[model samples]
Target: MIGQGFRGPGADIGDRPETFAMAQALENCSKNPIDPEDGTAIMTTDHAQPPRAREQFRQHLATVLADLQETAAQDGEAVALIGSLATQLSDKFRQASWSRAKDAMSADNYDELLQSFEKQGNALHQAGRTKQAYAVQALATSLVAGTQRADTVIAQGEGLLDALIDRSVALYRQHLAKRH
Candidate 1:
């Protein structure tokens, strides 16, 4: 009913019913409500933007990861700093508008990455790696915040997410090395 008079056979255009029906279908898809939690639409409205956003996110993620790798190399134990970073991550995520990067990626991808960090963080905590655990949890929080923020500025968000993931992975690796 929404796109009825605009694109389908009911419209003024002399298009075939099947074609118009397909077009209507597409329109409906694009209009599907976004997931309130993730702020991404069920169907991407702009097909062209997703690839660009995804590529930009990937590049930004890479750069941040590189920076995080460097930071991890010079790692120190700063419990206060980790707590503050975690709080920042939470605040940023809560303030972000996720709709901007909705088509950039799938929720599963984000979930998988975040889950990995959480799993690693808990393990580290259980093994008496408090600093590393806190850091890893903060990293997980950053990924959500970064992805949410990317909707506003892709590069900035990607960089943040990338850096967080890189740091989290590095910490996890360090824990593994110590365990073995």
Candidate 2:
């Protein structure tokens, strides 16, 4: 929920500087947390992301696979489709991220740079350097937008895929009914 507790993404952030500042403060405060009872670590806001986010991503892929299996003519077809789609999407994601990173120092260092910026932004905020922190965070946002676009493309693809699934299911039911 890194972007949560902030103004809606659609809001005119430029029109409300105070809102932006407040959002930054709230974001920094919740970036990391500790379990109060057992004193265990709770959540982490590293570039690697929290476990819950990763789990949700896996579940999303599983759901898509399930839908594919429901519509595929055979189990092998479904497996092959998922494999192909996964490979294509991973390549696309890497390409997009690398395109963004190319002008910067080096493609391989892009991830490390993003993580460094994020950590530095948080550190600057803690040090009461809000303006500098905001600037650094904005830079990080720009770098990450490429991968975010890849995710959005996948989501858009899912929407179309879901429509196809619905149609396939309907046709399947009709065929079963006719057999009876």
Candidate 3:
């Protein structure tokens, strides 16, 4: 199985430099696998990620949020657009996580096995973390636009759930691959 440490970089989204460094180290180790007894394969190092990628991800997230906000502001189109945005956001997260997991696993860093597991677990947990917040904001926006209704709210919630299923299936495939 691919080591978990290699998976850390994709999942690390915090202010701590140390965390990023550790994740980078794990990624490096995965890329350059060495004998466990050899001191050359160190487990930790200070590695900085490219700023451009981070900025891009942040911008993408902002764009999604803004789009959801704008969609909710509409009256007749609220339900349809909200459903579509939620589905799109959910797909984005799933694709991102799958890409990360695949990259980490392909690195072949044995030391990162545990960390990869953790990343998988954490990714699964936070898969839909933004959905609740988005739904709330969407609901608020809908209310402001006089589009609030139990049916609309429930439909939005159901659409989000469907998105979660897509993510879950992708994750499960990764998990199954690791197991076999």
Candidate 4:
């Protein structure tokens, strides 16, 4: 019993208080068979919400909108991109209807789409689609120029929408890190 953590027939039931406590702990664990360190049940399901990048992007757009209202910021490629994103994200957020799930892609999938925005645009652009070609060219230009002129980017056809999002996320994170 001493070697086996005082379990299964030790002659003395009345031992040190510490020994009784240890035995009680072992009995409780045997009865429960759960990991106690993390204070979490083993059979629980994760109910966490999705990543909030799109939501954050929406808020960022609102800030831009406010800035525009107050004449604190000028519209640019970033504005154009943000406007498009606002519309799309609105649908995803179910602002229009409850049945948006069929048409809406998940935020993770949307992020992936942005990452391959160039490739996807080029695929259509190369097929002699006039509008697509224009968009691809514009997005490429915005990406190469390293500027956030959202209007021109949208108007010209397409620009590196993913890069714009990535850049915004990085900048926002940097700002937060500094604030902390």
Candidate 5:
């Protein structure tokens, strides 16, 4: 409970920016809950994630994409159709995010949720939250753009689903095998 009751630097958790984690910590557990044998408290941070977490996520992403590719292959026309859809959706998505129109994705009323998802996903990847970023990308991949297919939308907007996922997996796996 050391960090509790005291608003140390960077302890800001809410609007007041004081005694935030303190309250949660106080409510969650004993002042010094320790095991009779070990006599120590476990410490971890939700915001500060480990690097391997991303590597694992990268692996998971590769698996999901590979599975998706296999499943998509069953549709016969899915690859070609989705590629075409990807192109259209990417164009529209770009128009929404980067174009000068007031109705763009950046606009308050237009697809704000999607904008948030894309921005947050990229930020996650940048912050070593690769798994979460991949999840976000996967979410976007499942969402349709107007009448377009979900796979096509995500593919056209950022990358071909199969290629992006495959490359990310290989890179992460290699990195994982290298060092801590």
Candidate 6:
């Protein structure tokens, strides 16, 4: 039987019975050919690390949200810009996640993923975060200027109203004196 096994032109039946036993075990355990459409093994292999990847994505999203929130609290214009950019960033991340879930991890596809991330970072930077920092620094100056202007207008209007009231009272007093 051993000679028959080794007689196959290039067969290497070594002197080790353990090796033969292992080969027999592997042959016995071999599964039937898989159908292309039934990709359970592939799905399990690819999705094995999905939870870790999801955690990483969530961390990145949190960072983006925090940065956008800080920028939005500065001024109306900045809030508008940052809020829009944040929305775009969120859409890009969702697209990236969908792409990954679909197993489109080719080099070109990865490059697109990287480009999306870069665009989000660039948008965040350009959304006036730095300018918002400056706006915060100048907030006290703006408040003082605004308060002074409003106070001046209010004081002038109040003074004019007081003068009008005084004149009306004087006129009424003169009318009463004449009636007496």
Q: Model 5: number of clashes?
A: 1
A best-first ranking of the candidates according to their lDDT comes to 1, 2, 5, 3, 4, 6
**TM-scores of the candidates in the order shown:** 0.30, 0.31, 0.22, 0.22, 0.27, 0.23
Worst 10 residues of 4 by lDDT: 1-10
Candidate 3 lDDT (Cα, whole model)? 0.33
Give the poorly placed runs of model 2, Cα more than 4 Å off.
1-107, 152-180
Clashes of each: 0, 0, 10, 14, 1, 0
Across residues 93-180, which tens digit of lDDT does each residue of candidate 2 receive?
4532223222333333444555566666556555644434433433343333323223453344334443433333344444546889
Model 6 TM:
0.23
The regions of model 4 sitting more than 4 angstroms off are 1-90, 93-110, 133-180
RMSD of each: 19.9, 17.8, 18.4, 26.7, 21.5, 34.1
Scanning candidate 1 in windows of ten residues, the lowest lDDT window is: 1-10
Task: Encode model 4's per-residue lDDT on 45-95: one tens digit a residue.
Answer: 121212342233223333322333332134333333433433344345554
Q: With candidate 3 superimposed using the best TM-score fit, by how many Å does residue 163's alpha carbon deviate from the native? A: 13
Shift in Å, residue 121, candidate 3 = 28
- Displacement of residue 112 (Cα, Å) in model 2 is 1.8
The digit string of per-residue lDDT tens for model 6 on 104-124 reads 333333334334433432342
Candidate 1 lDDT for residue 82:
47
Model 5 Cα lDDT, one tens digit per residue, 48-123: 2234432333343344455445634453233333333333344455532111121233322234434555566546
Give candidate 1's total backbone clashes: 0
Give the better candidate number (5 or 6) by TM-score. 5
Please list all clashing residue pairs in model 6, or write none if there are none.
none
Candidate 5 local distance difference test against the native: 0.34
Cα lDDT for residue 171, candidate 4: 46
